[model samples]
Target: MGRTMGLDYGDKTIGVAISDELGWTAQGVEVIRRRKPEDDMERLRQLSAEYGVTNIVVGLPKNMNNTVGPRGELCIAFSESLRESLRLPVSMWDERLSTVSAQRTLLEADVSRKKRKQVVDKMAAAIILQNYLDSNSKR
Candidate 1:
């Protein structure tokens, strides 16, 4: 099976993660600096092909009450676009506390605030993907 990609889409930066060739583990890949839609999609297309990615797992940032909001709506739209452009099955996994969790992790790692801001996006992407993999894994 081809590797799966995890995306943490945000207003300014899009964090990227990739699953192992075996699709068992997720690792931080890169943070694509947001640009025009055309440019961003071009970059994603290239990355997908480079890694032979067949599936995309995007983080759905739902509210604490498990309700969809503007951000979640935007994510759904983004997922739809990705599905059409990439021609891959796109799935959304819950990302309720991923950012917070990532922040906590950064604190534990004693990452400097400046460094954490730079890397947190990618790290959050990894956490989101790892959760998906862990839940879907079979013994």
Candidate 2:
């Protein structure tokens, strides 16, 4: 089976997570610095190919009340772009508390605020992907 990728899309950075080839665990991969849409698409396409990823789980940032906002719209657009460019099944998962969880995790780990800023995105992506994996595994 091919691996799955997770994305935590943000305004400045897109955090990436990749599942193991066995499809068991999720690991934070890298944070892709956003430049242009076309360029980011190309980079993702390359990463997908490199990792043999066949599916994607992108985070959809929704308000706590479950309303889609501008950031959520951007995620939708990014998912659509990924589907078109990577030719993979790109799905979205609600990521309301992922960042909060990430922050808490960093705090518990004694990570400084500055360091947390650097790794929070990747950790959030890992959390997002792990949640998806667990949900699908329960099926």
Candidate 3:
């Protein structure tokens, strides 16, 4: 079966993660630098093909008050674009604290600040994907 892909969309980059074949866990892949929309789509298309991604999950960073903010709106738009361009089932997961959690994990592991900066986005993507997988597996 094809695996699920997770994306942590941001202003300057998109963090990527891929689920295992059994859909049990997620691993950080790479961080895609933002450029033109078409360029971003092309990169995603290539990654999808390479990883046999059948589904995509985009992180939606909502406000603490349970409302979608400007950032969340952007994520929704990105998710729509992914659905149209990739022709894959795209979903959004609440990721209000995903990045923060990633940062905390990195700190706990004693990752250097420079290294953490380089990898936080991808780690956040993995956190988002793992959260989604855990919730869905309970169903």
- Give the residue spans of candidate 3 off by over 4 A: none
State every prediction's TM-score relative to the real structure. 0.97, 0.96, 0.98
Regions of model 2 farther than 4 Å from truth: none
Q: Lowest-lDDT window of 10 residues in candidate 3?
A: 77-86
lDDT of each: 0.92, 0.93, 0.97
Q: Is candidate 1 or candidate 3 better by lDDT?
A: 3
Query: What does candidate 2's lDDT look like per residue over 23-127, in tens digits?
Result: 789999888899998888888888899999999999999998999999999999989988888889999999999999999999999999999999999999999
All candidates: CA RMSD (Å): 1.0, 0.9, 0.6
Ranking of candidates on lDDT, top first:
3, 2, 1
User: Taking the tens digit of each residue's C-alpha lDDT, what string does model 3 give over 18-119?
Assistant: 999999999999999999999999999999999999999999999999999999999999999999999999999999999999999999999999999999
lDDT over C-alpha atoms for residue 4 of model 3: 95
Top TM-score: which candidate number?
3
